[model samples]
Target: MIEEIDSMKNLQNEVGRNARLVGRILDRLREKGKLNEGVPLENGGLIKIELNHIANETVKEHFLEIANDNRILAVALNLFHEEQKKENPMPVILVSKDVIMRVKADTLGISSQDYLSDKIKNYDALYTGFITVFVHPSTIDSFYTEKHLPKSQVPELKETIDIYPNQFVIFKDSFGSNKSAVARYNKYTDSFEHLYSPESVWDVSPRNVQQRMAMDLLVNDSIPIVTLTGKSGTGKSLLALAWELSKVLDEKVYNKLLIARPIVPMGNDIGYLPGDKEEKLKPWMKPIYDNFEYIFRNRKTDTNIEDVIAGIKNIEIEALTYIRGRSIPKQFIIIDEAQNLTRHEIKTTISRVGESSKIVLLGDPEQIDNPYLDATSNGLTQVVEKFKESKLSGHVTLIKGERSKVAELAAKLL
Candidate 1:
């Protein structure tokens, strides 16, 4: 009887041990599987891990293959992209610092989380070197006329302030009409232009100061290369077109004008599209035509369409492929939609600018159509970043999208 009782006790003890082990496993799963409260993971089931943000092609492909394996359930990512659904079909998630990647992931039905729980640095403040300041309305004029502020008064400025000549200053007075100004360092005048007054041609325009700087660089004719960057509707293409028109027709700065933009589509391969090069380029070049139509609006009355066409012929419009082996001289060149171009492609385009030829590259760094490049690393952004501080190089960021109210709202919201 005692022997039988011992066997029964052993069985009960084993059962309890098994139950405890199962409970521990469940706890681990719950900890790993559940998304943190208020975290913006689209699907909720994801574990954030620290990983490299930028990976090479082979590494990316290998990771995708690993993600597809059914046996693996949890993914630890330094960066999570909802749009990386092409290779990872499973319920995968990402953890990344990149806001665009999170947005892309959410759109692609993937889960995401931030890698760091600590406070993140304010990116805008870091990049622009801006400091928010409050000033008495009476002293607003004084501040503009005199660039110098009292050293004692500088203490009243907010902490973590960034100081850059290109930085903007915001005056938040008690009054409702607060004014904003950009700090413009004038190499010509050997002083700072408050950007509120008409001290220089460069400082008169507050909205497109960066673009104005770019135009100035082109106009100086000291540099053969110039690049302009802004978001869509921020006057990149229009400014380029305007500069070309002014230099070519009005000032007689150059004998000819040339223009081109890449033929790339969103989320698809160009090989699938039917038709010849011109047909493929027509859709992508629609924005270019829109600018031309607007510019030639009044000129269309006396000059016919054929005349304009002939004029454009003198100002060549050819694909980037055809630009190779061509030597262009005495030309004002503008390459619109240049965000799609690779570093190699940009190098090729810039090299083709012959003696006395000026080249203007304009595009939205954020709206890059190229798969390999992003906002920071793309050719357009790269060029601007590399050349911004140089005397011969300048850049302008057009903040107010002057296209329309609806367009502005759409850019902000959607």
Candidate 2:
């Protein structure tokens, strides 16, 4: 049974429009039932839907005491409490995406939990897109001399290493051995290919192996989707933007560079700052502009910020809101701060990618500001985990910070 409240206008609005996942689910239920309030499953089970009106005095009292300022939550809490009082009372647990709502349920002595259906277990064990494999010293030599080595030749590599497509492998001679080589697994050939030397993208060279792998994926035309996750100073955005600029301007791989981000606020809405759309986005997009400035400064010592901005004619910076209902083709699209988006939103954005377009999702999962999301449940991590095995997609988790010593220290110690 799915219980809801009539006072919850959000649910009512969704049901009325028949939009969003919830609304669509409810619509499916309506189609299966004569009264438009139930759904029959393939297992011969029925799910009855109930919408309760807020009228109980005890519920009103609870609302007055605990949720006087939030009517929707109060109504949901009232429904939960009512469900608990049934003759054959089943366990009533409130599942919510909002942390505060779950806290309020706890305060009301109600069982509550964050929605866990799409959440990943053991985020620490999440795919890093790379693994270390110890092999004989000759194996490293063979990789260097032949440019690639068949997986069957690496006898020391355990069968349980679970290498996925496009995953990077660090070949070491032995434990604490100095002889080492970095290679990417090619699933097609079932071999490990030698890593390309770090190449400059708009005069910005990768400072580490992780960044090198990231650049390889970013610039590769075969892999159309790339995800980069790391801490603030790890250069996720810088690398993505630099590669995007290189692709659009230098190589002419794509027609345009479309950069966007979810408009989630750290505290208050940007709408409160009193400015137009572009003006309001300035604060959010300042980091992207900073990357552009760095690239320009590196390319030309005397380049000014305005000169850099003016030179960029093939780039478009817009909110994610405008991306829907549009077919974005033949572009290098970069979605920054992607950790703030939900799985559904991510799917929608990705589905908008037209023919020959590449999309890069860059974010620090640890730095998500969206209240309803966490590192394990956010869209960025979802994409990383989902596409980890796909040949057309590649992901890199950047660890080394390139911003500065202070930034790196703060990311670590602070």
Model 2 lDDT per residue over 1-414, tens place: 223332343543323332345545766767777433557877896665435534446555655553433454555567676677898766666677778878867877778888888888879998998988788888999999998999888987656567888899888887566999998888899999976655686778989989988888887888899999899989888888888887888889999999999878888664665579777777877777888887777464566674566567888988887887999999999999999988878988999999999999999888988876799998989999988879989888999998999999999987
TM-score of 1: 0.55
User: In candidate 2, how many Å is residue 290 off?
Assistant: 0.5
Model 1, range 181-267, lDDT digits (tens) per residue? 444443444333454322222112224555444445556566567666655666667667766776787788899999877766777
Q: Please give the lDDT score for candidate 1.
A: 0.57
| TM-score between model 2 and native | 0.85
Per-candidate local distance difference test: 0.57, 0.80
CA displacement after TM-score superposition, residue 190 of candidate 1 (Å): 4.0
Model 1 stretches astray by more than 4 angstroms: 1-189, 192-218, 269-280, 302-307
Candidate 1 positional error at 270, Å: 6.5
Return the lDDT, model 1, position 102: 66
